[model samples]
Target: MVELVFITPFVTGLLAFVLPSALSRQLLVLTGAVHLVLSLLLWKNTPQAWFAEYFAVTPEGLLSLLVISLLFFLISIYTTGYLAAHGLKSENIFTGFMLLFLSTMTMVTLSDHIMVLWIAIEATTLASAPLIYTHRSGASLEATWKYVLICSVGIAMALVGSLFLTFSMELGGVTSAMSFSALTPVAAQLDPAWLKAGFIFIVVGYGTKMGLAPMHTWLPDAHSEAPSPASALLSGVLLNCAYLGIFKTNKIMVSAGLSDFSGTILIVFGLLSIVAAATYILKQTEYKRMLAYSSIENMGIIALGTGIGGLGVYGAVICMIHHSLIKSSLFLSSGNILMGYKDRLIANTGQMAKQMPKTFVAFFAGFAGISGFPPFGIFIGELFIIMAAFKTGHYLAAGIFIFSLCVIFAGFARQVMAICFDTPAETGTGPAADGKDVSFKEPPGMIWPQYVLLLTSLILCFFIPDALYQTIVDAVHAIGGGLQ
Candidate 1:
């Protein structure tokens, strides 16, 4: 099942590229559903390993793999309905590339070798480049340029970090294997100077890809320009892959008795991201960009949680799960609104419920859930984070974390309310009854996937089952020895 989870997407995508555009698109539905089934089987049953080069199931990696794979499945279904009605040309290329992207992301989580993990991370950058430029416009080209350049540069630094890690252990009596088990046992004897320097590069490098504040400049532009499905994955899965790199490095640091030094860096970057996100949200005119900033803020919370260690690791993992669901729903709803409004600016749009009731309501619910409203997963995740931070005596970090979240909430509330409620600009008033701005009604396929993601996230909020709790524990444990 684990092997199928990885191979199915790659094989299907290649086949998809050769078929007619419509046929290729429909195949996505079959592929997605099958992949989801395999993931569930992998989640519950015995471990299934592919060839040494490919798949293995670990509790932590399986958790991330399931989320990413499930998201791809839902989005693939939506894409079929989307392209069928809209008739995008040669979109078979998209399905093929997406499959390749999934293959690489799958490799990233499951790799036992550090070098293989680095390569997979880099592969994702290549596979996703075309997705960002799907429209072939000047704006999309510009966005793609920024994404490729920044992510490539960032990945290079991580490569350097991986190499330094190798060298650090060599200075001790350890033979380096780059396996998590192999690295942890020998970490304490490694050279501190080289390890510290390596971690800095890893954090900054992968941090750029994760959209962590100062390194996050490329993110808003990329997310704003990519196809909506692509944006959802970028915000949801891609960020987690980047974090896996940092998390793995931190685990090595923890084993080396250096978590205290490494964690401070995460805390500082995390808080800066929160502050930046709150500031940007208050000033954002484009609704998509605002959602992008919201992503940055959420990533900050994860960083802060992980930095505090202990229960904080659990909090970070919980944040990862909820943010993926909530943020993707937010972007898909943005797609619906963008299709309706014909403009991304909040001030330029108005009275969504009047124009399109289902989409408007879904958008509102997603906004509320993402902002950490009650009975939502983000609220629970955040509450855990607060408790974890306080337990660690990170009083200042905890206070800043709470304060920043409140400001972000206020900013998002003011904007979503204004855009969703206020009447449309007088200039663009009245339906396109005469056929002016918006032509098609909101696409049902797109709306349906978001609805699925949104409702599932809300459900997950009320129940944090033991399996998931153990998965979180194992994932944090994958970063082994960090807290203690």
Candidate 2:
């Protein structure tokens, strides 16, 4: 079952390269459905990987797999319609890369060995590179180059971190397998200095890929330049895959009684990322780029929550889940807005409610959810995180967190109001291309996916299923996280 989760997509991706464009698009959706179903089955039964040393269904892995599977499926649907409208020159390449991207992320989630995880993450960088360059424009080419180069360097650091982890095992004279499951019980015996160094390197390496501050230089460019579906995957699930690596390593650090050491680093980096994102979001001109900065801010929040542990870790899990849903929905809606306006600049967009009412609903609701408004999972997640911070005597950090949230909300709200209510004429911007002739009705494929994602976020806010709630608790428990 574990093999099937990735193998299906791998095979279909190869087929996409050879098949006609039309058939390849269908293959993409078919593969997504199969992958999602297989992932659900694995979650239901908790199957072992065919290669236990390299892969397994840990609770954390299961949670990531579920998000990747569901998001890919919905995004694939959006892609079919997206491709039809955009009329790319090489649709087959785009389709193939998307499938391969899915396979690599699945591999990241299931990987247990440190080296194998590094390899899988590196593969994701390679697979998604072409997708960012899909437009083949000068700007996209630059974005793709920066993405590949930065991520490759970061993944190399992760490889070094893996080597350090192996050295830690050797220094302690432990003969156990180097897989995460095998190491946790004996983590106390590992050399603390070596283990702490390994954790630092792992966090830096994977944090770069996760869009944490000081190492997130490539994210805004890559996200703003990539196609909307690709951007959705990058912001929604790819960052989570990187975070899974850090999360797993932090678990090892906790088991080794270095929680303070690891947690402090997480909190510091998390705060920096939020501050960095808040600065740029206030001045952002492009809507897609604004969303990219939002991704950075949310990543920071997740890191902050993970660092605080206890209820904070639970809150991080909730935030991770909801951010994927809401942020991806926003990116897809940006696609709709791009399609209608043919412009990416926020100042060039206006009267969304009058011009594109369907997209307006999805876009505005996504904005509300992301701003941590009521009836959305993010609001609950942020609330828990704030309370947990106070409980943990992190009053200064909590105060900073609240201030950052307000600044981001104010910036995001200002932009959203202008987009939804302000008329182009009033803003001194001319009408959009085809503004007078184009129908207001957006394609169901493009619009409905966002609706479904937002609705799921809403429902989860009100009620979570017993199985899922348990899964969340189990995932957090590995890192000393609990309700108390």
- Taking all chains together, each candidate's TM-score versus the true structure is 0.94, 0.98
Where is the poorest 10-residue window by lDDT in model 2? 429-438
Per-residue alpha-carbon lDDT of model 1 for 1-484, expressed as tens digits?
5566767878988898898887787777788788778877877884756554334566667788888877888888767766665556678998788777887887777765778788889999998999899888899899999999999999999999988888887887677577765687788988998999999999999999999989999899998988777888899888998888788788888889898998899999999999999889988878888999999999998998888888777778888988998888788778777777667777667767667777878789888888988887888778887887888899999998888889999999888986777765556433432234444477777788888998889877766578776776778776642233
Best by TM-score: 2
lDDT agreement with native, every candidate? 0.82, 0.91
Give the winner by lDDT.
2
lDDT of 2 at 131: 93
TM-score of 2: 0.98
Model 2, span 133-250: residue lDDT tens: 9989999999999999888888888888888999999999989998999998899999988898888889999999999998999999999999999999999999999999999999
